[model samples]
Target: MLTWAGLLTVLAVLTGCTGSTPLFGDNRSPGDAIRIFPEDGAENVGADSRIEVTVPDGRLERVKVTRMEDAEHGQVPGRIAEDGRSWAPDKGARRLGLAGKYSVEVVAVDGGGRRSARNTSFTTLVPADRFIGYFKPENRSTVGTGMIVSFDFNRPVRNRAAVEKAIRITTDPAVEVAGHWFGDERLDFRPARYWEPGTEVTVDVGLRDVEGAPGVYGSQRKKFTFRVGRSQTSLVDARAHTMQVRRDGELVSTVPITAGAAKTTTYNGKMVVSELHEVTRMDGRTVGFGGEYDIKDVPHAVRLTKSGTFLHGNYWESPDTFGSDNTSHGCIGLRDVKGGSSDTPAGWFFERTLVGDVVEVVNSADKTVAPDNGLGGWNLGWSRWKAGSALR
Candidate 1:
């Protein structure tokens, strides 16, 4: 298991490798004797492409492939056939990357051991299409174990299978990950249980030129990665008016808190923190409560849901209000000073919290939060989660 710190190592090591002049052979060599699938100087090749090298007469001694990706050149590992007349990439790595530039270098030999080399390069097709998915947690970021890889597509995906198949996600130590589509435009992926602390996840968005809709095609080619940090989950007991914080499955601390008022009960279920703010405005009207309240600057606010549910610091209430009362408009409140201070409970918790950390509310009068609400998919049973997968 690799911790959040592991993210920096991957970023530094895999950062792009620059391009250079052709190697292993002369670019001016007469490639007439060698045959390449993407022909020499070919252009506009599709994603479902074949790359091979063969010699009509002599045996192919060696074949090398270099793909220009993210301004980096990665060698394609392959094996020459037993006959030594043809060569292709390794089984799983055969799928050529979309919108990439590939260069193939080959060497052929006869019984005498004399070598003749040929070099060829081609460019893959760049999509003139418009369907793209905007994903979260950012490339190379380190998030908490509760983080779920989510996507919000720019348009409705009619060919869900085609679009989903193009995107591949893998995790270190090899845990099974499954995708669950919320609707035609939103998709999310996660393991059956919360990710173990210190796991590295990689995503290859090979959607470029893939038809996602009737006529619209995918228009992005990208590879990104993120790491899982330490595990932290807070259990908010609405009835008891306290929150129990745990780290690595061990109880750490318990703090007094206040949940929603009787008229507007807070939602119950697992909700992941998606954003943090030192201070933010909270207006009832914005969240569909017709102007009941509007605070200009709520300090130490942690956003929990898209529908304006927050776990924020409340300075207006009396200190005794927490731990003994439920008096908010569907938000959870922690005690803090006016502007907010590190010494206050709310500020202290906010400083230590990560974006993907979980905050589960129990014993609340309101119904469970919907699975589509702020990474609430954790509330869904494993069987139900897989049922939402477009792949199914």
Candidate 2:
């Protein structure tokens, strides 16, 4: 019914409104290719390490890591990173063989929702049978001044020379650094004295399946950098019943602390703070020597050992009993409220103790704290402890 002139006008109007048609079609992009970082060949990884994957021109939706010869391979445990592409292994991932190859697979999607995948095998530098330690107060940084670099091995190391060689330490101005073996599985690296404040430190661990003991091996290679913080080491001798807090070996403050009683003697040795809790429960039955009538709740317990020793607040004890008498079964009790909410002496001291601060106990009739208990590395004699190593 429309004339040619009218049809031409309508067509021209539509064409101008729509503009030119696209020759390349919709604005869709291609799928991305998943890739693994650290490549196909990587070495010197820590035993407790994670895997990383990457994707280009896309984002990874999922990832899988599997050890060869084992069917218990794993997919991504947590949320994948944005950009359609990266994956990290679980925090507690464990592999079978140390030197064997591991297969990793990654799946990704592009901006256009196109799917892509990648698979590759990588040989981890760290082996199974090995234990490696990464210590705190890293090399070359300001620390708590009382902090120390401590390592915990899973197995006892017998190869002292090899194990010691695997670890390297250096400090500013070249201070004398030594690796003191405190027990079969613990090694405390320190200078002759506390680290100098405002100084830098470096530690290198070059152990990968290096034999340490009969069946123990090491699987870590690391270089840590940290700085020195303030200097504070408080010495508490039970004989003096006085705590001398020192900075750079000079006396700062001396506070009086009541230790263990004669019958229930406190441990005689150097102990480090393993943990701190504002208020924790103390079970008498768990430590072996309690009937139904015994007190089950020793509140405000700040545990110092796995064997049930603590520096806790005791509300049952009199307020004036702290500095005068040692009445606890084996622990050092400080006066506090019944519910562990009190800010008494025990609460204050326990709150101030860091996880690594050294608390020396002497003159106790009880045996010294074992080096293997908690982080009590200071219990062992340096030379004697070193002799226990197989590498020696």
Clashes of 1: 2
Candidate 1, 149-169: lDDT as tens digits: 888776789888787788899
Off-target runs (Cα >4 Å) in candidate 2 are: 1-130, 134-148, 156-158, 182-184, 209-217, 225-228, 237-256, 291-308, 338-343, 367-392
TM-score of 2: 0.55
Please name the candidate that would achieve the greatest TM-score relative to the true structure. 1
Local accuracy by lDDT, each model: 0.74, 0.53
* Displacement of the residue 145 alpha carbon in candidate 1, Å: 0.9
Candidate 1 lDDT for residue 288: 50
Clashes of each: 2, 26
